[model samples]
Target: MMTVTRPLTGAVVLSCALSGIAAGAPARAADVGRSATHRVLDVQARRAGLTTAAGGYPGWAKTTAPAISVRRSAAPPRLVAGAQRGIDVSRYQGNVDWAAWAATGVTWAYTKATEGTYLRNTYFASQYSGAYKQGLIRGAYHFANPATSSATAQAEYFVANGGGWTADGKTLPGMLDVENNPYGATCYGLSKTAMVAWISAFAARYKQLTSRDVVIYTNSPWWALCTGNSTAFRLSNPLWIAAWTKTLNALPGGWPTFTYWQYTDTPIDQDYFNGSYTRLQVLARNHA
Candidate 1:
């Protein structure tokens, strides 16, 4: 599940307000012992009207539905009871025929909208609006770059674009794509302590702006290596695990369960939202 990020050059990184670390730059081994200080923002910063964190729990209880299965190259695994189908795409899935895709039974879609402070996906507008126009529940995500930019700044950039939320039953909550740093070090050349603080700031700022928690997308090794195996986000941000295996292993970050599983990358980044279609609608509408 460890994917290499597209390397960013110094000029691009500087323009984006990201850390100065060059892609493939070496880091001192003693970085492990470094400490970081972060200013914690108010959890309830913006509104008395938006959905509180407690109210935002994705209702995980199963709803009755016919099982839907995907055939792997070998054979299709039996569908997990109550799981619904979806996919996530970036500019790489250029000019998607969203209607035709949805006709194949995809219920939801997450499109990459922004990365770091300035890198808006070239296809985000078309893909995001296209998915919604096709009657699919759509969400947007920001690929995190805590090394060059402060998390709050990047969160601000994400929300100002297509990543904002509404109570209308169409938009899924925004996601924080905090995995291996695409531009620099695996953990963005940061200490585990710094990485944790960066994520905290990003999540808090996202909540302040959108009044909804951002879904956390990561794999177990990245979670452990980058965030000191932090579970602080589990209660607020739903987990979207990236484990492409025959069997899922124990999840890191102390998550009791996952909300989405990205199972494949070939036919596209196919996934399962952990509930029925009706429950998916509830999750979309829950953001006040």
Candidate 2:
């Protein structure tokens, strides 16, 4: 595994460059055509308190959600020698060292593609393709913003930017990162029923566009509170559970088991496919 040298405490950036960030509060559709660099800058601005409760990259929801925090493990488990090791990155990671990661046994990755109806990852081009060059199975993910736009609209936006799925065995299905609202409300102002409907609508639209089932990345408690533990997607969509503990525990939304487990966040977010390398290939080919 890639040896992470970053400290255990929350990774903090005390200062941020906010010169490119928009002034005051955000408009309903201010992100429509902004540059990807500026989009990432906006997230940094929010984290630095310029935009307050605006938006963030993936795993941002882990902070403000319900009692989901636990004593983090020193390192994520290996399970077995052939465990399918992986990592997820956003513009926050900038350009990555895929070669070093591959040398350390990282065989797959998910690169953040888009958020809301706009704001794509600035480093997506490099990060997504760089992993592929290293012979790693890679895919894209969209951080959900249910309050800003329709689920279908966001899904279309996500796919259009870079979340598209390919049948190639190295290309996994696109993922929807739905969790606590990084903005104001805990559930993005949507009630439990509305949240479930929103997710279902997004999944259906994504499938309509790609003819592939979408993988959902969410926290268990957040899922319970936001979707009322809806079981509508139990069989169809694959689960990518975010639980940063030593071992996996109770799952959310009636999913019998998790397909992908995001078990930690230190130097960067790390994950593992639940099955073997061949099984991971099956999922990539949309067979699993």
Candidate 3:
């Protein structure tokens, strides 16, 4: 009795048929060209595995990679055309020629005052004061340590060491450098609840004393991990976001709309300061 075995009931038969088609489907001359293209692409992709995807490789990965074209909403306003443009400088500890720096179009400067509870380089006071004397718009900064057991103590230290606003009763906003610090341990250490209370208290006290809004300077990581919630801190407060590549936007998942972008820390020539300064420019036309 000739028994007809059930047709090889397995994926192996199906795979064989698919493989045959994959090989024979390119019989036409036109299909041959397409097959050649696919084969070349497959080989190249295998070689580039884990490096490139449909989005393509990054700029630095290979010199042959396509240039990345970024679309900016609008060109940043020139600092010279506006009020002024400058950078914050502190304990990086380098000699700066204020006149030479000023000549490079540096219109303002923010000097580091205190780090944690301790005062930073004593020279900043003199240098900061000198910049003001030389006619550069000047402000002061305090490196915040939110992880400190006492937020009030940290605030008090900043108030004491950072000094009062200038004689004009006008000062650039008080900056709180809230980036990574050992006390905080990590970017998110200052929880949203804690941050709101701490920032509110700090701002309230700062305004009562100096009558200027407290400007919060932090990177995207800190903002997302610590202050992404709507209830955290005052949204109206000017935000200085440290985003090296892209411009701050109102979109979610991006850096919040920042008043200032700390684009680069690498030294660049400025007009109003004595030496090379990190270049920071305002984002919007309105200073608010």
Candidate 4:
């Protein structure tokens, strides 16, 4: 498998510099610094959980049952309109009032669940439950550290914590968050071939247990580093691309037409939440 080196923590400092928050201001400056600090803390917390190495069946294991095939039917339930909009949430955001946000054109949400082989977000269950109670369609995400010893373990962790697929044979499946990590390696330790095998095994096991497809969430460079061929993995599973370029049209060329676009880091007004809320939209392909 190809080995991907994790970016250094200095990247976080650089991110703060680019945030346009002036340095050494008064109390307001402190707030900006606090936000930057929190952002780094969130990333560190997520990375800590994602680095564990325990779980998932090995590739050599016999296929006890057939792998579940994810089919996109023409009549899939529409979670959002063509201009679908939603947000991703975690503990950092805190106690989201889903009902309040629902009124603000926030149509869907993806919550952070597991990070790696052993750790889970303590807040995931309550937050996810809250979103559901408030009638928001929800998905879960796993902060992926492909450099860890067992990618499959990380996948299993996400599946177990996020709750297996829903009863309708469909799930707001878990996404693999493959952005740059500061402490560990990237893409795990697999070459493109091995990466494919490892991820396929992991994804297949999750599908077998949950009966839902595992979605791959990535940016262009990360995807290229891990799986050079975006189409090599399960084609039917949905793709959630993070392209924060100012224009919505700047999506990478190789990605399957994405189902969800993480357009920006800034949050929009959401009544259910105390502060700003992130926005997202479901793509038409996955709606059905």
| TM-score of structure candidate 1 | 0.72
Provide the overall lDDT of each model, using Cα atoms, as 2-decimal numbers.
0.65, 0.72, 0.45, 0.48
* Location of the lowest summed lDDT over 10 successive residues in candidate 2: 28-37
Runs in model 3 deviating more than 4 A are 1-83, 167-170, 182-184, 229-235, 249-257, 268-288
RMSD of each: 14.2, 8.0, 23.5, 14.4
Candidate 1 global lDDT: 0.65
Best-fitting candidate, scored by TM-score: 2
- What alpha-carbon RMSD in Å does predicted model 2 have with respect to the real structure? 8.0
- lDDT per residue for candidate 3 within 151-177, as digits (tens), equals 566666677776446445224666777
Q: Ranking by TM-score, best first?
A: 2, 1, 4, 3
Per-residue lDDT tens digits of candidate 2, residues 201-230? 999999999999899998766677678778
Candidate order, lDDT descending = 2, 1, 4, 3
Please tell me which predicted candidate would have the highest lDDT against the true structure.
2
Clash statistics: count for each candidate: 4, 0, 17, 14
Q: What is the TM-score of each candidate against the true structure?
A: 0.72, 0.78, 0.59, 0.62
Residue 123 error for model 4, in Å?
Answer: 0.9
| lDDT of candidate 1 over 132-243, digit per residue (tens) | 9999999998877677679989999999978999988999999988765423345777888899999999999999998888999876656665676887986888888766
